[model samples]
Target: MKIHVWNAFASNNSGSYTIVGRFPSEELAAQVAAELSEVLAAHEQWFRSPTAPRSGEGSRRETPSPLRAFAQVHSLTQGESDWADQGELRAWSTGHQVFLHDPCTLSLPDSYEEFLRVRGGKVETRIRHAHADIVSLFELRGTLPKKTKAETVRALVEELHADDGPLVTLAPFNLQPAWREGSKPGEPVLTVGAVFHDRDLATGFTAVEGLARRHGLDVTVRVSEEQDSRDSLAWLRPSHPPLKRKMFDVWLLEAGYSPKEVARRLGELRHGRYVDVPGLLKALPDTVLKRLTLSRAEQAVRFLREGGANAELRPAE
Candidate 1:
C-alpha cells in the first residue's frame, strides 16, 4: 500500500529553516503554516505598541527593519516527492522566537526591563528595542504520584465534566535517559498533557488542584499572570485522537478498493500504523469490514459505494 506524508518548514528569519512537523495531509500542514504567519503579524503589532522607544529617546530607531517569514510544504512518497511554497509574510521586527518557559525554573519577563534581565547579562543593563514574550497559553505535563493514580485523575476529571473541556492526555515517557545518567532505573513515566488557553486558566487550575488534593495525587498545578505554556507541549498534538472511541464498522458487500487502496485511504484517516486490510478481509467470515468513527465510516462508505460496491455501517455493540 502506498502512503503519503507532508512536512511543513518555516524560516523565522532565524537565518535557516526549521521543520515544524510532519502531517498526514497537505491541508493540515498548510493550516499550521498559516497560523505561524499570523503569529508573526501579531508579534509585529506588539512591537509597535506604545511601549516602544520614541525618536531620539535612546539608541533605538523609531522603527526596526521588517521581519520576513516563509513556509513551505513537501509531499513525500516512497521514492519521489514534490515541494510547494506556501508563501511568506513581513512584520515589524527583524527577530522572532518562540519559547516555552518553566515557571518554577525561570519567571518570564513582563516588561522591557525584565526582558533584558532574562535575555541579557552584565555590561548590558538595557537595550534599544522594546521586546516581550506574550504568554500564549498554559500547559500541564507531569507524572502522577502512582501508576494507578491516572484512573483517579480521569474519574475526577470526568466527574467535573472536564473531559470535553481542555484537551487531556496521559502518555508514557521513556526514562532511559535518566537511567543512563544514573538518575534512576528505567521506568514508565506517565505524563499528563493538558492545554488550557489563557481565558480558561481558572477552570483548569481548579480542576487539576481539586483532583490532586482530593485523591492525594502528587501532581502540582500552577498559573501565571501572562500567557504561559511550554514548547514541548506542542508535541502532544496529533492529527487523530490518541485513544480510540466507540466506532462504526464499515462493510463492503462487493469489491470496493483493492485491499491495497483500502489500506492507503484508511491510513490517511486513522493517522496510525498501516492496517493489514487483505489479511483482515480474508480472516473475517463474511463481508469486508473496517472500524472507523461515524464520520470516517461514512466517508469510507461513500468512496466504496462510488466504486460500485455496496457499503454500510454497523454500529458497534
Candidate 2:
C-alpha cells in the first residue's frame, strides 16, 4: 500500500494541517480512514470542546489532545498499540506503505495530458463522499465566515495566487532544455520554489559549478530577468549601433542558435539565400525588440544589416 502526504495551509486560518494520502490495500486503507476520524474527534475534544478545560489546570486530563498524539507519530510506529491506548491507532499495523506526492492541486487540468504538461506528474482525479475534502476540512478548522460558498471559493483562489508569489524567485535558475540533455541520477537539480536575486544568482552559479549540477526542474517566476533589459534594448537598438548588435545577439541566443549555427546562417544570408529573419523572429518573438525604432520599415532593414543606418541612408519619408 502506497501513500503520499501533502502539507497545506489556508489564509486567515490557524495551524490546520491536513494529510491526504492513498493506500493500495483496501483493509489498510479502511484502517487509516477509521484512524483519521478518531484523530479528528480527539482534536475536536482538545481544541473545540467547551467542557474540556485547558491542560495542566484540567479535570484529570481525560481526553488526550489529538495534536499532541499526532506529533508523537514521528517517534512512534503505526504497529504499536500504545498509540491506540493514547487515543489514535498505529499506521504500520495496517500493512500499508507510503510515498511522497506533490501537494499542489492548482496545476491539475481537466485532461490528464494537460495536467502532466503543466505539473510533470501522473495523477488520477476521483470523487468520493467518504474522502475528506481537504480544503473544506482546513476551512472548518476555525469559525465560519458569513460569506457565501461562492465568496469562500473566490477567497481561496486568491490565497493560492498569493502563495505562488515565491515562485518568481526562480527566474535565473531557468536553464535551457539543451542544458539538461544528459543529466545523471541524484544530480542536484534546482527545486521549483527556489528564490534567486542578483546576489543569489552569483552564489547559485558558484554552487552549481562546485557541485557539477546538471538539470533544473519546475522553475517559476513572476517576472523574467530579461524583461526590462529587453524592453529598453527594443527602444534603443535602432538608434545605437552597439545596442543593435547586442539585441541581435540576444535574439540569436534566445533562439537557441549556437555560434557555429549563427555563423552558418549569416553566411547563407550574405549570399542572398533569403535566410528568413521574419520566420526566425516569429519563432523567437521578441516583442520588446519589435516595439523599438526598428519597427520603421527602412530602419528595420538597416538595423538587421548595417547596424541601424548611415546618415546618408536615413530616409526623409
Candidate 3:
C-alpha cells in the first residue's frame, strides 16, 4: 500500500493550508500519522497563551483562538487492498490518486465520471478523511461564477482536473455575491479573476457597463484629446445646438456627473471664469445649455454642421 498523509490548516478568511507526503507501507502510514499528531500538538503549544503581557500597554497582543491544525490520511492500493469495506470511501480514495497522478486514467464511478465528461475533462476529487478540515485538493485554477455552493463545488472539480501540478487544498473562503440586494443568506459571492487580454478586458468592461446602466448607474468611456478638441469646436458653432446639447447630456450621464455639476461647470465656462473648453466639449453630449435649453433641437443641428466643417478643415499635410 502506498499511503499518503496531508495536514491542512484552514482559516475563515485565508482559505486552507496543506502538507502532503507519501508513505510506502501501512506501517509507514501509521508512523507518519503519529509524527503529524506530534507536530500539530507542538504547534498548538507554540500558539498557547502566555501568563502575562510581554510588552507595554500600547503593544499588540497575540492570542490563540479556534484556529488549530488537523491531518488526513489517504491510501492507494493496487490489488486486494482495493476491495474496501466501504464503497464511497474506497471510490473516493481511488479516484483521488488516479485523478492526481494520471490524466489518462478514467475508470471512475459512473456518476462522477459522467460529471467530469460533461464538464469537459474537469474533475476534482475530495476525500472526506477522518478529519473534516481537509475539504479538497485541486490541481487546476478553475473559472466559475461564485453564485451557489453547487457551482463552487463544480468549479473545484474542474480546477483539480484541468491544472497540472501538486495538489492545492481548497476550503471555502469569503465567497459572496458582489451585489447583495437579490442575494439570499449563505449565497455564494461571485468574483472573476482578471482577464489578461485587452479584448477580453474590454468585453468584460462592456458587460459591467451594461449591468451598471440597468441599475441606473452612469457609464462613460473617456474621449481622447483629439476627440475632445473636435467635439468642443463642434459644440461652439451655431448650427445643431439641440443635438449638441443632447449629446452633452448623454456624455454627462455617462460620466456619472450630476445635472447640477454640469450646470455649474457650464456656467463657469460661459462666464470665462474657467478655461474648460475641452471639458465643455465633453460635457456637451450630456448637458443642455442654460440659455438655449428650449432651443436644443436647433442647437444640435448647428453643432453637427460645424463639426462637419471642422472635419474637412484638417489637411492631409
Model 2: per-residue lDDT, tens digit, 13-105? 221111223345536544544554565466555565565455455243554456445535533322321122222211111112211111122
| lDDT by residue (tens digit), candidate 3, 223-297 | 111222122223223321112111111112331234344344433323222335456446544333222222332
1 against 2, candidate with superior TM-score: 1
Q: Candidate 1: where are CA atoms >4 Å away?
A: 1-245, 248-291, 312-317
Per-residue C-alpha lDDT of model 1 across residues 1-317, encoded as one tens digit per residue: 99999999973321111111233343443444354456445545645667644344545444431221121111111110011111222111100121122211112112222221232211121111212211122222234555554565455434332323223211111100000001133322223434333223334444544454465433322212322323434443431113335545666554454656655554443333356776646654343334345665677678766554556788743
* Runs off by more than 4 Å, candidate 2: 1-18, 55-63, 66-317
Local distance difference test scores for all models: 0.35, 0.28, 0.26
Give the TM-scores of the predictions, in the order they appear: 0.27, 0.19, 0.17
Q: Report lDDT (Cα) of residue 300, candidate 3.
A: 34
Q: What ordering of candidates by lDDT runs from best to worst?
A: 1, 2, 3
**Model 3: runs farther than 4 Å from truth?**
1-13, 51-317
Candidate scoring better on TM-score of 2 and 3: 2
